[model samples]
Target chain A: MRDNGAMQHSARRDDTAAQPSRMQSAVFLPIGDEGRAELVERRIAEAITGGLIPAGERLPSESALARSLRVAPVTVREALVALRDRGLIVTRRGRNGGSFVADSADPAQFTAKRLGAMSRVALRDLGAHYSAITRACVGLAAARADASEVARIRQRLANADAADEKAWRRAADEAQTEIAALSQSARLTREQMRLQAEFSPFLGLIGQDASAREQQRRAVLAVLDALERGDADAAASAVDAFVRDSVALLIDHQMRLHRA
Target chain B: MKALQATDAPAAVDTVTAFFQRGVDALGEGTRELAADVASARAEGPLTRAKLDAIVLPYAQALFDRAGVTVYGAGFIAAIGLLNDASGHLSWWQGPRHSKLELAAQNIGKEHIDYSELEWYRVPVSTGKPHIAGPHVDYLCSDEYTITVAYPVFVGGEFIGVHGMDVLLDAVEGELLPLLSGETEEITVINAVGRVLVSTNPHRATGDPVRDAGDTLTRYECEGLPLAVLVS
Candidate 1:
């Protein structure tokens, strides 16, 4: 009877793929030895713009952030002040208060600036990193997930209209993440989600074009088709191409946006 | 000699049973305390998230501390049907020094799954009995091979959810290996799902299905739990 309302998450059976701490992904990753407050500010700013930390979401306590990022509490404090000045994060003092990403964040507002600032080399590197993780996740999903699971996610993806980029991005993100979960490795799924949060904002800027959104929709569907067929290589390759195409498109868009 | 072995078997199984029962009762005590808090607080007014967290978080922390190394993960999976939020309200916490689980969180790129299908959540809610589930990979939470002991939480007659602890497979083997030692013949312990918990046979392996034993083994069911000691 319980199965009547059951989620189709049983695809994670390979047993070799356990992985991620929710907080430790991108936001909690250690900063460099530079020890500069600006670097700390920039690191957290990327997480916010990337939407890894959602608007109104409370950040780790100053001490907690300091310990995880391996920076001094004063450095973290300095970064928070800068983030507040930039209107990226806000601090409230109370029993429940801590730093929170400002609710006014439109994601696109922060992402445009972030995308323009990145060198094409850094952009390609980001895409390659995301694709490598996605390839593994899709390959595992193909080997472990049932056709029904893939079909359920495909149905969600198929229903999202490319014209409505926001809704499409939301559906696309949910679809890809659910498919990644089929890898049954908590770490892979966690990284996949983190990368999506970190990468989707750029995709959002690029996806503003109708053609770009349509192209991405087709690529996602192709990957799903291969996954449903239980062809791991086919599924993995489809995702690689999907990511390759988006990254290339994003690089072009960035150059075009800032044309001299 | 046969009569002596028959009595010895029950005594041996009882020791293993008592060991698991003590852990179950520890988790159950917290469930009852939280359920009482919820029921009484609801009697006064509406269920606020702050109030719920105040009731649930302490119990979660205590369960984590009290169970110590035995429990790798601990918390409450609120029956959203009772709580009336399809999105879910989970107060689960896990270790390597306490992190909240996002299995039920609604985030971009993250889907909130209906956990009712999972045996650990399903059995206790359906049977209204405490249950011991798995030696399987926990994709939803710990991402480890886990043996989950769950006690159903009920507020008056309404089922609130489950208060539970996850013992990692390594720790489970640690607890079971000594209890299962010195057997005259090969023996395997399997969970409710028939996944081997521990076995003396090198080839059988933990998580091997009991059905694969191929009629060569004799199965003795552990009293009240979905566990068995199989001798071949």
Candidate 2:
């Protein structure tokens, strides 16, 4: 009877282990380059957030991750790098130490530092640079943008128009970045993304007036219309004009505050 | 002695006119060569840094020589391939004239003359049209102005560039006006669009809209003139 009980207990433990392992495998089926990295990092982060991988729980070895995911060790490394950048995982060198979820992470510090950097940059100069780049992108987009790209831009613009000031600013940032990406110039897109990151904090500080924001929405729509019409020159001009006007408004407001 | 001096004045005038005509002719030839050189050079790609320098330095030197005439300044187009893409390269150059030309043009659109102001479109050597010296003349000469010449560089009937020169009233007032036998007529050379390209009178000069009203004096003169010479 005792031997029978021992067998039953061992079988129950095996079943308990098999269920989560199977669920995890199902949750993370690595696909392509970006998809694989995203899946691993997302799974790891969610596990930590949900206390599934509790603080101080050592993550699986890189080799083990590779074996389980049927992906290369390099992908595991990339996913770890992303999680490290986010401050969710800490790695140490020693016999006992591997990667472990951090016990505490302060999101407030991350946000404050990001915002403070933005506040220091002059909005007017940012506007000018933004204008120059976006104009170039719009011109290029008119020539090369595919149907899916057009739909994405239209969707972003709609989101921007319907959003409140804060939401609009964020949506505007994404839309501009998307437009730059549509140009298919990696260098241009990288530079624009950097600019957007630099501007984010100050964008949160200043509120765009409703009328001006509405006008900007209209201008973006006009650009989309030009794109739809397949008028490259007009699209370029419209984008350039919108950038100039938006920059002017930002500069005017900043100057007024300075004078007062 | 009186007859000798009178004859000398007409002879001097003829000589000056001949010299100007020769300079204009030489400019035309040089411009054609430059355009051909530009087209060939830009065919493969934009003129390289060394080649662009090679072209512009000599062209600018020639422009400065022409500006040395009674006219205060001259500017020409220099095409450089700055933007290159799948569509190939587009290149052009403009003016190497006085730096103040930019400042003077900027003063026109404003209510008050802001001395510190600088306008990008006004820059003397800037590639865009309504070249600086033309606008400068318009600001300085009013409705009583006359004679603005924009000698554009054409190669094979296409306007590849321009060499703008103006003869304003102020420059002529102290010297040439007294010599004319008839009443001093206001001759304004306007571009096809009616923007005063150049004028002898200071008031009708800079930034003033072209008046196409019933007034025959300023009724868009010079329709028959070459489009290359008209300033608007």
Number of the top-ranking candidate, with lDDT as the measure:
1
lDDT of 1 by residue, B110-139 (tens): 333446766688889899999988664565
- How many residue pairs clash per model? 4, 30
Docking class of 2: incorrect
Q: Among these predicted structures, which one has the highest DockQ? A: 1
lDDT of 2 by residue, B129-170 (tens): 222222221222121132334444445554444444444434
Q: In model 2, how large is the Cα lDDT of residue A126?
A: 71
At residue A260, candidate 1 shows an lDDT of 38
Looking at model 1, the pairs that clash are A17-A185, A19-A186, A19-A187, A20-A187
Tens digit of per-residue lDDT, candidate 2, span A1-260: 99778756765776667455665455445545767877778766654543334456567678656654556889889999999998899999998778887867432233333333433245456766866776776666665555554675786567454447645755665566656655544455656655654544334333346676676667767877777665778877877687567555545545555566
